[model samples]
Target: MPADLCPADAALAARLPQGVLRDPAPAYLEEPRGRWLGQAGLIAAPRDTAECAAIIRACAEARVPVVPRGGGTGLVGGQVMSQGPAPLVLSLERMTAIRSIHPDEGVMIAESGVTLHAAREAAARVGRQFPLSLASQGSAQIGGVLATNAGGVNVLRYGNARALCLGIEAVLPSGEVMHDLKRLRKDNTGYDLRDLLIGAEGTLGIITAASLVLAPVPAETGVALLVVDGPEAALTLLSLAQARMAGGVTAFEMIAGQGLRFLAEAFPEMRQPFPAPPDWSVLIEVGLPDGLSAQAALEGLFAAGVEAGLASDGVIAQSGREAAELWALREHIPLANRHVGAIANHDISLPLSEIARFIADAGAMIAAEGDMRINCFGHLGDGNLHYNFFPAPGRTREDYDQYRKPMTRRIHEMVVARGGSFSAEHGVGRLKAADLAEWGDPARLAAMRAIKAALDPVGIMNPGVILA
Candidate 1:
């Protein structure tokens, strides 16, 4: 109930259900990165799909923009609208419900507001797992996960959010509820609207609920950390593991010495297994069938890697606690980076063959130009690296603020030149919309614009997002 709310918006608010309207709060106005503060004429948290549709219909008639919000954990600005007329922020936090789960068919139909952690727990109850694992899963909702097509560590094996989703139910910009949440594995429909909305980042519509795929839990799992000479050796070791594991490789993450140093600097009390962090290492996980020893499998892989000169040393987790500790090191790298404060970060993905080359070239170029510290690491199995730049010792991020933009543009240019993406897992929210426009193909840009104009004639859905 903002004092400046337009008359049409006020009338629309009166027409909605009693509990749907919410008071504006700071959480709904800002994204995680604190890049911008949003303006909302109204906040609507619908408890069900019917209420969600009603709110959208009223907004449609009154021509008020609608910005769909999930868990407010998005790194991009998709959850907020900073400019234009104040919008109605449609939050899906109250719509969390797992409608049904068919373990036999490996599918779970859940409302969009269901947090990823809840879905995973629900699947675990039936001896299955939801493979899309992100550090923010505790707060990231299923709708937003699908909307952004997020990719996490397991993407090396289970694939991205788009692949795990079987179907989705979304409300189009015009307030029409598209009930396409099918459990069928194969549906050769005329046009797959489900695919469009999954990665549209709410520009086309707001996703309400979805049918997600659940994977069977592996009988045995093992984790290991191996020291590699460099990115090239890491890539070679990955190939060796894949050839031997035969689809058993669960995750293959690359870690740089710089990342470990930052962790030590940020969290002095955190236990690090290595006496001194190697220049480069990879933490790999494997899953095997019953009666197969995961530890033995990893031991064999490690021996082979060493013989082939791909890895020099390694450590295999002996128990669940040890495995969790090892994984903790890899997961904490981002937190360490945040604590150190980066001047520039690029979530770029390169062709598998071009990864090592890009890293070497980019690292060298940046090093030759300045005293910036580089921490390049991520899901090397998928060629997506979080290439970040930090100020040198005794310096702050503000000291090199001028280099953030040009450095990001340069890094993205290098990635695109190698036939990779500028925005790998994160959707092209407001942050990278300009990059998308400058680097996107002419034909693809035209098609996207046409789709936007056709689907949202009044353009009330998440304006100032993907498109320029």
Candidate 2:
């Protein structure tokens, strides 16, 4: 630890809400590098925007780097307090509150600390859908979701967190709250600052509360499992679903045979969504507008797909429980993957047209690396793939750790070559900061740096993320 950059002093700690800070035990230090902890530091939980703003002000005054945290579900270690003069962990978990739900206006305002699942439930109570549902919704807070601009299964129809958000209330780096909490669908503002902070990964500002746009709960939602030969057929089926179903198609997820096998072996509850496992499967959902027939829309797509040779067989969910079970198979992947072995995970995106080709080529390239199992699956509708390379069947955990950096670089380069992104839904936390510096465009990097410098002149807020 840098002697000059030690833990926060008594004065600073006293300013925080009582019992809101923790200095990790010495034994907890030097355990491992991960999302949760980073050396010994002060972790402060504030109750509201005012408390958060006050914490920021104190940190700014002390030239202390403040890492804003919401649920700490971030994969990239962005929320860890690692550096600077008494780097402080600014947690918003205590401020969780669903402020209001305006069903008529289709807006739900909630504190940043509110869990996504909580927000979704609150919206559902009024017969609306928040539409930013994700695997981590149970623990991922609204602030973290907005900070990462999280995209989930329904992004094909409802868009990502950025699109679902109408306006944000954030504390800028200079300790001033930029409150633009209006629920307006159209605002001809001189500058859309809300957008700036949405995906900034807490580097530019600290999100406090947000006004999120809600959609009326779909009158009917149909889920199905379509077995296809491969990625090409999956793409074809997606095109067919989009064309034949009109605006009803919401989610179109593709899972490879290998990924399915892994899940089946790892998770006992996850059955094969097909009678006979095919090379690939598309988990689709169609959200019918009022007076539209969801079942008819899916049945037509299935018939057309079989006729066109895009799908070999399919199963339409007969009830809500069936639909939820079918979705559970897709949503339980990350958890199931953990039981397999250590894996290098990549959240990447390419053009919809390039997906099939990229999957084919990337799979072959990765195979050449030798002795690794590839569990590749994701939201094919939006061109995002969670391409995870599992450790060799018998390799020790340490062996897998050794390949982390080099393998990640190789895969990222391959993704980049196919006009894909290295980081898709997951934002650049500490894990990707070096990669951003290495592969990111210089001009784009400059703009990000300028914004960081302008908003956080002292670099007190969530530094070493995207810009650093």
Estimated TM-score for each candidate: 0.98, 0.94
- Full-model lDDT, candidate 2: 0.82
Kindly report the root-mean-square deviation of model 1 from the true structure over all alpha carbons: 1.1
The CA root-mean-square deviation of candidate 2, after full C-alpha superposition on the true structure, stands at 3.0
Cα lDDT, all candidates: 0.92, 0.82
Tens-digit per-residue lDDT, 1-468, candidate 2 = 222333356667766656666545442222123434464356677788888888788888878778777776777777665554446777788888888889999999999989999999998999998988788888899999999999999999999999999999999887899989999989997889999999998998899999999998889889998888788889988988898877688999998777777777887666666654567889999998789878888888888999999888888999999999889888877876777755588989999898878778878887887778877899999999998888776775467676777888888998888888999998888778888898898999998888888888988777778765
Clashing pairs in 1: none
Q: What is the C-alpha RMSD of each candidate to the true structure, in Å?
A: 1.1, 3.0
| Candidate 1 vs. true structure, TM-score | 0.98
**Counted clashes in each candidate structure:** 0, 0
lDDT of 1 by residue, 93-118 (tens): 99999999999999999999999999
| Candidate 1 residue-wise lDDT at 140 | 93
